[model samples]
Target: MDLTPESNQDDEAVGDLSFDPKGALDAGDGAVLTRLARAVEAVDPVPDDLVERSLFAITLAGLEADLMEAVYLDTPLAGVRGAAAAARADDTAPAEAKTITFTHDSLTVMISLSPAAGGRVRIDGWAAPAAGLDVELHRPGVDVVTVASDEDGRFAFDSVERGRASLVVRRTDGGGGAVSTPVIEL
Candidate 1:
């Protein structure tokens, strides 16, 4: 599948959405997304001003007018806008939200990040061939952990740090796979 961000064909309106990378479907007003789309179309490298322009468009639309918002940095859509990540899913729902699946040898795993307790990051993972697995968080620092799953093959990182992180899983057989959840700055 073509995952290039430049593909406007993916912008085909899906039930009113104009194919948001952040997956913010337009229910009515297209101002913010329209400006985003135009900016994306105008240059190979999107200008930095587009963020302010998008925020301005959102402001004009009166969306969350009081609090600060932007396409980058901190924004509601940035939190869970995994539509690009969704393309890797085995199945696609109309909602356009999905998980990434990695398989190695007899092991198959699906992983995603969510808000953890105490304002930490949550690593929710499911694996096949239920066994002891090593989960590592890689960023500027490395956190190594090993976890054995229940009969259902589910594991989690409840107190993971909030920032860009990747999950690497190692199986007992020494073969493993990794999936990088989209960078989320909490």
Candidate 2:
């Protein structure tokens, strides 16, 4: 068979069609773009909390706090927050409470999450080497809440809405720098 455009019935060359990159798109062009967008969405949809997650990451990146590593988990999940976060999505699973422990240098922080009064979470936390400290609760789309730890290095948040959250701890006496736990799904 002849490879030339003339060999075909239509005889339309590949270069026959033209598109102006800077020019305004016509109705047909708009329809084509719209179809492309819909196809992309159908193939790979975006997460509902993508923007929140992105903002959370950006905020954490600029905080300059020491990132504490997850040391212990009381849930069935074996790994860190990532695994725990994944495990909590199954509603059919048992309503077992979760405890996560994170540490940085000499400071050890532990938090236990349980059901609260209004379908929220109650965060009871304790820090070792008990000193005056400030713990801030951070969620993707909510305002940060701060509470001071008592003399016993214990603190509690009465209620918090469930979602991706983290805790940032700082010394109240202006001693050690700040430290933050990994983002976990609550």
Candidate 3:
């Protein structure tokens, strides 16, 4: 006799969900899993924006917004980027004062770095199309700092300790999405 119970032809009720264990994997299941694993391994595992999102999450203090593109001082660093720096024997060290620019679709921010007393750094920043905005300074292992920009879109962080840092700018009027700059060495 068959072990399975015969269903009533006249029954109209729906079948109950089965809770019984399906038991351990068999050779067929293992083969399917192996094929799936191989297929996954054939493609790149990491997402292209993983690094950008992770950095934004950690450095931007959990700000949800678009990331601004960093415009390296290309004109200023042309020599450093090329063999010109290597050819120069007089001043081989990187410049003490560095300028960086970050831009988004709606905003543009420029910052200047200068040395301060006690081996600290001073950051002077200016945003274009002068408007009310809040600027946040982020450094690893340190509290996030938020500052307000002046009418001229000028802001400054005085006597900041030297380290890697990032800047996040947001509109004070809450008009648009926030934007962040890539972390850079101070």
Clashing pairs in 3: none
Task: Single out the weakest 10-residue window by summed lDDT for candidate 3.
Answer: 79-88
What lDDT tens digits, residue by residue, belong to model 3 across residues 47-110?
4334654664575646776878888656464422132223222234443566678889999999
List TM-scores for all candidates, in order.
0.40, 0.63, 0.59
**Candidate 1 segments exceeding 4 Å error:** 1-98, 103-106, 173-186
Angstrom error of the Cα, residue 20, model 1: value is: 43
State which candidate, 1 or 3, has the greater lDDT: 3
Q: lDDT: which candidate is best? A: 2
Q: What is the C-alpha lDDT of each candidate?
A: 0.49, 0.79, 0.73
In model 3, which regions exceed 4 Å deviation?
1-61, 73-95
lDDT of 2 by residue, 63-112 (tens): 78888988763556444444435445654444446788898897999998
Candidate 2: worst 10 consecutive residues by lDDT? Answer: 78-87
Per-residue lDDT, model 2, residue 102, is 90
Given candidate 3, what's the lDDT at residue 128? 92
Ranking by lDDT: 2, 3, 1
- Candidate 1 residue pairs that clash: none
Model 1 is weakest, by summed lDDT over 10 consecutive residues, at: 62-71
